[model samples]
Target chain A: MTGERTVGERTIGEQVVGEQVAGGGSGTDDFYGRLRAYEGRAAVAGGEGRDAVNEPMIRHWCEAMGDTNPAYPASAPPTMLQVWTMGGLSGHTGGSIRSEAYDELLALLDGAGCTSVVATDCEQEYLRPLRPGDRVTFDAVIESVSPRKTTKLGSGHFVTTRMDIRAGGELVGKHRFRILKYAPARRSSAAKERTTEVKEARRPRPVINRDNAGFWAGVAEHRLLIQRCTDCGTLRFPWLPGCGACGCLEWETVEASGAGTVFSYVVMHHPPFPAFDPPYAVGLIELAEGVRMISNITGVPYDKVRIGMPVELEFLRVDADLELPVFRGAVA
Target chain B: MTVRVGDELPPLRIPITRTLIVSGAIASRDYQDVHHDAEAAKEKGSPDIFMNILTTNGLVGRYITDHFGPHVRLQKVAIRLGAPNYPGDEMVLTGQVTAVTDGTAEVSVTGRNGIGNHVMGKVTLRLSLDFPHGEADSPQRGAR
Candidate 1:
């Protein structure tokens, strides 16, 4: 009860404030020591940003995530999009955060008396589309920090970071992430406390039948190609084995004009994918060939992409040999 | 008989479910726990949700495209998401045929979540309309 104490007699707040005010009282700055320790102990996690949109990675990311939307015409086995975007697609792939960084961050939070940490929200805005064959530099910066209160978990701090993804001297995407950390709640003496581990769920490989073999193959080559049914002459995308309308098995592989108009779109304030930062727009675009492609609309402010707006395609590499196709409003 | 301007287009019922949600997520490469994990979602801040807006839009667009047939090209679709759509919620995609010309038609579309409008927007179609009007069918050869 002497200084700022939350848990019984262990006063971390008092210690922190005391150290800050005392200046030179404590033996060697524990803040720096603690920071170094955290750097060594925190969990390392990262998100992937494309220098230029790589179509193969976009398709692979979707495939890994088991996306079956007809808009993405990639050919590949479904993996996990969240993991891929979170810089987890490869054990040690490109543009991923070192796990040591997570360990360090956790250590820092723990020293601050925060025991439980979880990713709460994410938002990303694309300035330019990511493409294949472009070497991109990933820059992650802590944007803001705030303390929050939760009924179930007492009190904690929220850390937000703005990740600026750049490729070829152009800003490709701006990723914003919010992480929540809480102090283990101190309950009544008589009540037994319940604690559980927050685990990242595992995803299984998507079952790829003959329906989408060609699409996946094109992804390996960083291509955004679709199938035009030889029978009905209808251009169908997201690669089904046969035509959706005519049920024709025979088809010709055609490249997308990659040009479309935004039919409509909605800005997502919530994180729908574990790998994604939130505040994005899921858009429906009617391609030049009369096919519709569903993708995340990037490069413009979420509120600015309007109905009947022109857009162009950009490829993203989800991982090696895998690509994803996303879209942006075509600038007039 | 042609649909009158402002006449309500026939309401199309779309089954909102988890599978569709997953499909849309996969297509857009947005696989978050809140979308696929029921328990994880409850832990976050959801009431056992169903589909994300991307999937919802996909369904709505599919409904119109299916109705319009292959020849009529879909020119545009503009929509907005209002309420959270849970699985099993009957999504009644309703619209009004706002405009129809000799070679095209425009429809205002909306997805209702029973309680209220979940998604609202518009769609435009450019029709070949069999053949171009007032133009001769034969290609004119260069004058000798």
Candidate 2:
């Protein structure tokens, strides 16, 4: 299955180069020379993402990550920089635009017994936020390839690729990904034991700035304060500086009535952080004052925290230094 | 509020689960066998399916906005990975304000897992200056 998929993804130009390189037995100098030749060459040109920036994928990503920020529904998370350039399971179709140099580079590494590959890291700069319905196009280049180096993973070469993602012909973001293709090293028992050591982690502290300092102070006082626009009477939950309705900079704090319903919610089941238990429910609670805030929904099983369920505001003491506003839901 | 160079952003802890690995991979349109198919990953010399770079990027972006609020605009996020994020592991992401000028702030961020530092990088973001500053409930016009 892997062999078939690999061949199917390669371009005709690459297959020809693969055959040429396969017959030649080269020394280390020749191998390094050949590898260096591919640097600065285009790896992919005019590649298109299988799908445009859309809501479903964004929603799926947010659900998996337990992120409920309101800004995401309209604009995509900036870190999804490479999703638009992926070829997926079937690989790039409709005549691969992948450069022959890239194929030969990987084939050379595979022939040298550096068959295993792992993504080391990536860097992204967002020029603009991607919105739904934007068709993404990208071009990638072999940014660099490092000389052989020995590490815990064994001896291998590092390959870095840079991609520029565009929407409507306008550059939107740049992504640089580095991967190590290496031969697996034998694991020592002592090294294996170190992986099992667990460290205690605290719940992430909420970002407190001038705009939201008042909200945290309210939480400290066990009061749920909603920001009310003094001029327009519009209420906002996140405590923004200005009113979205009247553009009013004047606002006052109105203590929430404490009655609310679950507007939307997600059950977190994976990537358990140290401070949180698995399968817990995080909800978007709609206060009776008609504004929504994201918080943990307690007092019920994660599965039973349904939308529209009544919930009351309460402060949760996550640690000695932190007290968060969470909601209590009744079991149906 | 005025952002100082030494301001520290809150830390966030993320769980590493098989479901998150698979979901994140698919969500990012990365169908690499090593990212979702454990058997395929074993064939490639990995212990199990691992998180993809796109997912890490998404998480980092979320961590930034979660603190700076929804109005914060991300300008750049350049990160380097040191350790792999595998299932049954936890990653704690921490950040500090390194520089601030003309409504733009540069932050240094680090995400550490059990094995070691998983990611390290810098993020440049532009903060909206229109928000009312000082005395949370009082109106201040054109206050810097």
Candidate 3:
């Protein structure tokens, strides 16, 4: 098969290898043409998820997002469409059905000095909810690759892959993931100097609407308010217009006693934002009234924050126009 | 419990912290370095580790269920991301019903962060409005 291919005086294999080594410049058009050829080719074929749809991952996701919807534990979250297909830290291993065309396409991009990569976005369509014990399988194709274009990061191409996720041989969902493979843009001296004059970014303002305006109003007066259903007398935090227990619309505000316990918490460490410092503790505070709210845990070091730790409500004046309700953990 | 076209669902405010970004990524089984390792992310020309699309999708799903109740079935979620959800930012998710027929509602959702719109798309969900009476506990109830 190798001997059969020929191009002019040289074999086709030799010509292909020579072209790859001669990367950009005159071959740029040919390079993109080769990339486009990968479109519709199998990226992953008959791939199996590292783990089945399970409750532990779902529970962990709910805890991280502060989502307590009971429907979980029964059925997996529809947004977890990609979770079942992930390869995890070790990445796709033995059972991986990865195709050579996909690898070759990426190598082509790498040879062109477009090494840095970042996921741009993804789209998902859930045909049905995934449940526990369902064996997940998928097959993906190289959907498309855009022409070389310069972006804020650098000059690169956008590669999109589409995957069909299935469980027990039945189609369950579809996912499309797009990424940019680019060469990092060099920073100019002027840009570096400007960055040195670092101006702190202001904290994001809270979104206050008709349903929760009264709660913020109470915070301005240094009071933590919880909404109580007028019909069922059920207490709720982060005010809602209707009662979840009884579906009552009428609600009244009650001043909280300012007492609470840390139900769960996480310490922020990476991806520093301008407004707040990192390594800070954010807690899901369960109030004495049985309602819970998310707030910053203060008056103690981040690592010191513990589950079940007692805390008191306090208003933090982040800036001139912004104030937030934070919890001050009891310092031992 | 009748969902009409043009009816806007209540907004949901989610605090974007480093913890949420990292934890959400891990929970979704996405071990991409850019979603958890700041140094690796910076090397790739990102300011820092940012939120993964799976996390954004999860948040969007949660926002919808929180409004329509836990019984709703999510049919589809198609989103395009703009600004990255960095730590210490807030993403306020707002949705409006664009079409409603045969017990299914199509909602156009937008998640805005401090920098700009983090995610914008549409969500199709089937709502069975037959929620059990007196079962209204807050969705934020501690799972412990």
Candidate 4:
């Protein structure tokens, strides 16, 4: 997959990870390498300007990321949706240069002799809600570069990239990503310190029970559904045994518009659980029915989804019995 | 139409202190001294080294957990970062209930640096709608 680049006649939805000849270029060893690199980034960046995110792309992202939120109104994750906007961040060029931007960046930093590169920190500020069918423009810049530090990965550099996500000149989100590039540390103090401070894994493993069986089924169908208490007329999520108010034991499922607003959230630099990636976002979204559910936010660019902004839901299939639910703003 | 869509939670203000930053760092496994070592941060060109983005995000998640109690399960949170907040910079964490269903709810979350928005994001939580609290009523163990 690294050398060939001609847009082969591979059928749609086919998982192709090999090499293909590109346009009329001689398959020189080094030439093909550079060309593949160039083609890779170009495809990722895509053609810039309006219409950056299309329905098919969104669906593909949602499927790959296993994000399920109603905002996608599909079985996908909002976080994966942000990748579409990142493509626009490459600018409005349909040329191979624009496509090669992300890879080039990786190659540039890698070529710069940074030992081991890893993501140390990330902060995504959602300025506005990102909705499906919205064309967004984005620009990313290297905001800062920190000196190398000793760690298990060795001495590394911290590079921060700031991406401003926008749609029709309106600010959507501000995403700041901090990447660490380091070499193996030889028993350095920094390595010991980081190792000592490592957080114990605590994954959020909600059990799959009968109460939530229906909700999981909805996910299989790409639907967002909730349950309500029949006795106290209360609403619940993750399908529970009793009412939150009247202590009622009976409940019924309800399908929602999957819209809500930011009640509160935090940026977690630590990995509370092994399943969760570091620099993760944890938040509480208040539904219109006076209910609050804990879920991850995804879809829109990091900088575009913000507090008090509107959002919707999307469901991601984690397994046959479990589906992860993610959220994004309903309107951007 | 008198139909329920989502519900709002009580607003909360969290003190953005050195301790808060420390707890988040510990929870996130982020050992950057800038988050804990004020002196080291100053040496690194930071104005007293503010909380890491990971800590900021964890705080947001904690806010929801605190309000909803332990019965509710957090599914996802999408947040962003803004101006660097030092130990002294207080943050106002807020939320809004935008949509609701029988068992699930969606909320938007925001964290501000005293003056303006420092972190903006959203979350979706799941809970038992029938009972006053879900079967899992016990609060989760505090982050180590």
Estimated TM-score for each candidate: 0.34, 0.61, 0.61, 0.33
**Cα TM-score of candidate 1:** 0.34
Residue-level lDDT tens digits of model 4 in A1-332? 11211222221102122323322544333433442343212223223343544556545443322223334533212233235443232343454423346556556546645534444444454544556556776666655554333343344445556666677778766655666654444445544444444443244566668767787677667776788877777777757777878988877778877788768777777533345655656668887765777778776544455777777787765445556777866446
lDDT of each: 0.55, 0.79, 0.81, 0.55
Better of 3 and 4 by DockQ: 3
User: What is the docking quality class of candidate 1?
Assistant: incorrect
Worst 10 residues of 2 chain B by lDDT: B133-142
lDDT at position B92, candidate 2: 96
Model 2, A1-332: lDDT tens digits are 11111112122112112212222445765777788889999999889878889998889888877778898858888877677777776777786668888888999998988887777657777888899999999999998887765556666778989888999999999887788787666567533432332234578888999999999899889999999999989999798999999999999999998999999999999855556768899899999989999999989999888889999988889888999888999987
Candidate 4 chain A lDDT trough over 10 residues, lowest sum: A4-13
**What does candidate 3's lDDT look like per residue over B1-144, in tens digits?**
667667788889988899999999998888888999997776556778899888998898889998888888888777766778998899999998766655667788888889777787778888776732211232212331
lDDT of candidate model 4 versus the reference: 0.55
Candidate 1 lDDT over A191-282, as tens digits, reads 22111111232222335677776676776676678788899998886777778898988999888778889987888885344445457778
DockQ of each: 0.01, 0.24, 0.23, 0.02
**Ranking, DockQ, top scorer first:** 2, 3, 4, 1
Q: Model 3 - which docking category? A: incorrect
Output the better candidate (1/4) by TM-score: 1
Better of 1 and 2 by lDDT: 2
- Please provide, for model 3 over A1-332, each residue's C-alpha lDDT reduced to its tens digit, 9 standing for 90 to 100: 11211112211112122212224586677888899999999999989988888889889988877778899978988888888888887877685467899999999999998998767656788888899989899999999998876665667888989999999899999888888787776668534533442345578888999999999999999999899999999998778889999999999999999999999998989756656667788899999989999999989999999999999988999889999899999876
**By lDDT, who's the top model here?**
3
**lDDT, residue A313, model 2:** 86
